[model samples]
Target: MKKYLQIVDRHKASLGTRFVNNFIDTIILLIINFILSFISAVIYNVTFIHFFYFYNNGGFLWNVFMGSVFGFVYFFFWENFTDGRTPGKYITGTKVISTDGKKPTTRQIVSRSLYRLIPFEAFTFFGTDGWHDSMTDTRVINYKNYESERQLKDEINSIGVKETA
Candidate 1:
């Protein structure tokens, strides 16, 4: 733990989970989107012709626009509200903070999301940890301030309220 902190202190960066809980969050979002699509189809009275031709042209464009807007807005709002988490980050118990030890700005969120559009992600083999960290000029941190997070969880699960011995 001390080693991790020390390394961070020296390098201005720290180790954080890279798997990105956004996949799960994205699944949830996809469901929401699916529902929305159904509603749109019903409300717009989009026929098979529209569905095949003009349907996606306008619908797809609107969906992408809305999704981008919502993503940035959600990120900025939640990162400020919970001290740096999207729904995904909250679920995963992680937060993003400025790498320079400052709070993230709205601009950072926009830039971070946009930067993610680049193909630099493919440049890395396994995870986009480095790319993301660099893009936002931010680093993800374990939500718990104490290093005993894991130990505490283990203790709670390992013992019962009653004493056996």
Candidate 2:
């Protein structure tokens, strides 16, 4: 667990970039949601006055529940496949990773995703503040250098190139 919470290289990302990524991701998701809802309504034949009233009145709670569930499902499916990136993180070239330099475990991914609901990782009590930013002890980092160990390999390759030339 401690290894999982390790900090990322400071050069990889900034707080500002993290913020914009989140904002853009949210806007894109909102647009997608609107499109889905429109499709649902159309398929249900909500063009007629009676149909609109019946569907809206009958499925209000269910619709909200399904929407919430869909959000979680979307995050889980995409994040796992994309190496901890949502659309926002992907656009910003950032991702979450364990400190120990390994792909995250299934439990780790789910926990981290749930922890994201902590509202910017901020909390307060007893006249002080606390952050869940370290919940995973994992750091948000630029994806490019996620594999720092690769630097050594690149250096070796560079030396080989010079010798061959």
Candidate 3:
């Protein structure tokens, strides 16, 4: 409703905040990929020295594919488990919510994560929203600001109502 828009409009995450969230999450993902790659190499009889360099073009591409897969899973579970907050979102003070100003459903989280696997999806942020957000009808917001605004709205709404004791 009108009150919902007021809170969301004032606290929606900016592109810059989104960028920071992605940056932090990507770094964490990279570290995870590195560790996994090393473990895989060890299981396959490759020496640690070769870990720094993939042996073939396919290996490089495999890493990229796995990275995307892991990223999807990470986004999905983190959002669902933490009420729309990933480690990056938490660090950046942001949260994801449905367009109607409610917590996103499991389907929304899954769809949002899947859309991220699209090529060049990050580039969508150049406009009003990223594909993952727009396609899933979700928005990332400044968590503290959104919560405060929502609290104020709740208080205002209760002002003219009679209490039932």
Candidate 4:
């Protein structure tokens, strides 16, 4: 609706905010990976030393693949279950929604998550929105005062209706 567009246009998130969110999220992911990898190494050392060596030797590409898998799961579940607000988004005071200014469906969240797999998707923030957002037809907006804005919009609408009456 026009009101939704007005709100969205007025509260579009900046690229810097998006970048900071991603930076924080990546740090979280890296911390998680480090802990898991450490645990795995210890387990392998105790059970099968040779297998541990093989796993560690799998090298950079293997690490990247594993990281990508983790990233996909992390983003998908967080966005889907949290109504498009991840830990990073929470910190940044932003939330994702459909381009039409409604909550995104499960399918849309999944599509957005999958798009994160694309190389350099983070850099796409230089444009209006990120690649994940663009591909899924979603947007992230400044949500620090979303409730207040919604209430104000509702009050304004009510006033308009009363005037018409």
Highest lDDT, which number? 3
User: What tens digits encode model 2's per-residue C-alpha lDDT throughout 45-151?
Assistant: 74555654444455767665555566566666667788777888888888866666556666766766566554444222122212323444455678776556457
What RMSD, rounded to one decimal, does every model reach?
9.2, 5.6, 4.0, 3.6
Q: Write the per-residue lDDT of candidate 1 for residues 19-61, one digit (tens) a residue.
A: 4555655676677667766666775664555643333356766
Q: Model 4 lDDT vs. the true structure?
A: 0.82
Which of candidates 1 and 3 reaches a greater TM-score?
3
- lDDT digits (tens) for residues 1-165 of candidate 4: 322355665677887888888888999998998888777789788898775655566689988888889999999999899988999999989998876778889998889888899898777877777788877778888886665797888898888464633
TM-score between candidate 4 and the true structure: 0.86
Query: Which candidate do you rate higher for TM-score, 1 or 2?
Result: 2
lDDT of 3 by residue, 85-136 (tens): 9888999999999888889999999999999999999999998889998888
Residues forming the 10-long window of minimal summed lDDT in candidate 1: 1-10
Scored by lDDT, model 1 comes in at 0.58
Greater-lDDT candidate between 1 and 4: 4
Question: Which candidate would rank higher by TM-score, 2 or 3?
Answer: 3
Q: What is the full ranking by TM-score, best candidate first?
A: 4, 3, 2, 1
lDDT of 3 at 144: 90
Deviating ranges (above 4 Å) for candidate 3? 1-6, 46-58
TM-score for each predicted model, relative to the true structure: 0.59, 0.65, 0.85, 0.86
- Which residue pairs collide in model 3, if any? none
